[model samples]
Target chain A: MLLLVLELAGTAVFAASGALAAVRARLDVFGVVVLGMTTALGGGVIRDVLLDVSPPTTLRDWRYLLVPAITSLAVFWYHPQVARLRRAVLLADAAGLGLFTTAGTTTALALGAPVYTACLIGMTTGIGGGALRDVLLREIPMVLRKEIYALAALAGAAVVALGDRLQLPAGPVSVVGSALVITIRVLALWRRWHAPVARGLDG
Target chain B: MLLLVLELAGTAVFAASGALAAVRARLDVFGVVVLGMTTALGGGVIRDVLLDVSPPTTLRDWRYLLVPAITSLAVFWYHPQVARLRRAVLLADAAGLGLFTTAGTTTALALGAPVYTACLIGMTTGIGGGALRDVLLREIPMVLRKEIYALAALAGAAVVALGDRLQLPAGPVSVVGSALVITIRVLALWRRWHAPVARGLDG
Candidate 1:
């Protein structure tokens, strides 16, 4: 039940982020929905594919599709209001990232992926959608740039894998792993922490 | 045997294209190789996942991984010469497109996807990598813009699906469908055919 709620909430938050990006790009209505849907579901789809799970869970489920569509429409209609709530959106996005990281790790582990593979897959699931969204918008993915985003996902995924290895309860493991990610991300953002840039590259 | 050959050849060609894009983007060696591998294998991975085939064929096969890596290295060293051979690269890419399109459509059909779904997935397989490469480089994907690129893949996929519906021999059907795509794409390029742009948008 908690997992279902987290899944839906993450989808909604990511969809909003994508829709906002589309608005900033000044794309047409079709593009807005495309970006939103992709951002919300792209990671899960990729994870499912890597795990060799057919048809992808997102493709099979109607609710997963509908939420993103509605979120896109909402963003298209009232982007100004959405834009004004940037801080709240960022918090929601952080929560979504944490939830998704744990989800990805657990799913991979359930499918018998090794600990290392599970951690990587988990990070991919958390970051894939946003990376795709940025790419579509003709921007270098923010995750690949200054912020400590992908690392946070990676760290959370590692925690999940570790918990599983230690034979911890699934529910507690998930909550703790996700909380670790959320705390790190929120602190990074508050402290204006940044990832190290490549040595020769101009900022 | 033919499928394996086609897959490797297509991966090499797509990897070259990705390496070229990385050169244009002035990315470092790591980025160049990463983009090349992604461009070479991204489509097939997506297709396999949608068909519920786990562990993506590319991930399972070392040769599939190796070909892209080698191709990327070759491009990194001989990019200037490769850039000079633009026409040759285009021809190779066209062939890769046809092969990937047929491969995607047929696989989906074999897995029992409906005709429309097969066609769409085939087109996705044909174009997904290039789209991903462009996205990573922060450029609008050529497939989504001008030229009859994706349409050609769709046409080929449609042909294959129709052929299957008619109970045609798989070998001949695949050959004919792929030939159709190559012919159409080559003709479109020669004639400078362009997909219509949005009426009021700035070109």
Candidate 2:
């Protein structure tokens, strides 16, 4: 299904971004790989736990582990090449954000979560790992600081929910949904769009 | 009840450990406190969310936030004195491990988890935050590597289960359970005990 493709791509890209952050922080190889794995799998693990499913999908499908591990080593070995394409990496991360947010919302709905809780879970699933990672690194999260992060995820999830309510076909809806998210995120990045913080950035 | 007192003490001690780790990781004052709060409260949050309890205890109780924040500041300011009494700190941590494991098991039972699952969850609650904190700091987690960490938690949880079956007085059972955990952990530390890895430390 189109959903599977989007999920796979999104997982790899998100893992790449997390591993990249760990490398930038000068973490060891195992640490880099660990961060990558968690970034790829953390959201889904939280979802399964919330949904009370044992032996979660990530564990059931060990492909989930292998993907991030391979990709992180590739990133680590090709550090110079990756560094030159930092902008491209960010765009891929945006793609990942959109993919994950929509998938999270869809998963919650399938599991019969109420709409509002579904939305919150989707947002948490999209951003929780990155937030945790950034907090540990002692820097403001990239999501917190830049590129209309949560907004883009929220928009994508809302669109997915709307499409489902309209009884749209799963394939076309996923394509359109992901495209919409990627387009919005890329434009936001290009325009340097930022959130309006409390009291006009008075914090 | 005495059991409740021990659980509260364990929470406080674990929060202190998180604050201390943050200090070593060079977090600023507010950051230190938040890290401590997260470490102390995260496992319980996971437990509640898994049990489908909305908003978690940390959000419901003001004390959960206040306790860690105040303790973090106090510990940060008094690290020099605290460091000088390392043995006492270890003893406190061992006692905390038993207390948290027991509390986690009890909560899981209250929520109708099976006995085995309760025990597993109790161990997770006792060690999860520390594991997360280590990963954040880019270090191998001590809970996973050093001492008889999970085993100690397991033993204490077993004691609680046995105590309930025997209808022992809560006060006496808690004291015996805590003392058992501390003794095992202390012995493990004194003897440089480690889990036998299949690969014999090839990492």
TM-score, per-candidate, Cα-based: 0.62, 0.61
Q: lDDT by residue for model 1 over A1-203, one digit each (tens)?
A: 87888788999999999888777766655567667888998888888877877667776677888898899878877888888898877887888788888999999999999999999999989888888888777788878774778888888998999899999977778888888888888899899997766796765
Error of 1 at A109 (Å): 1.6
* Pairs of residues at least 3 apart in sequence or in different chains that clash in candidate 2: none
Once fitted onto the true fold, the runs of candidate 2 whose alpha carbons sit more than 4 angstroms away are: A50-56, A194-203, B1-16, B19-82, B85-127, B131-203
For each model in turn, which proportion of the native inter-chain contacts is also found?
0.26, 0.03
Note the Cα lDDT for every prediction shown: 0.83, 0.72
Candidate 2 on A1-203: residue-level lDDT in tens?
A: 66787788888888888778766766555556656766787777777776666534653465666787798777766766777789988888878777777778778878888777776777777776676556555667777787577877777777777877787865676667667778888998898776766685654
Question: lDDT (0-100) at residue A48 of candidate 1?
Answer: 84
**Model 2 CAPRI quality:** incorrect
lDDT winner: 1
Residue A75 miss distance in model 2 (angstroms)? 2.1
Off by over 4 Å in 1: A195-203, B1-46, B49-106, B113-123, B126-133, B136-138, B142-203
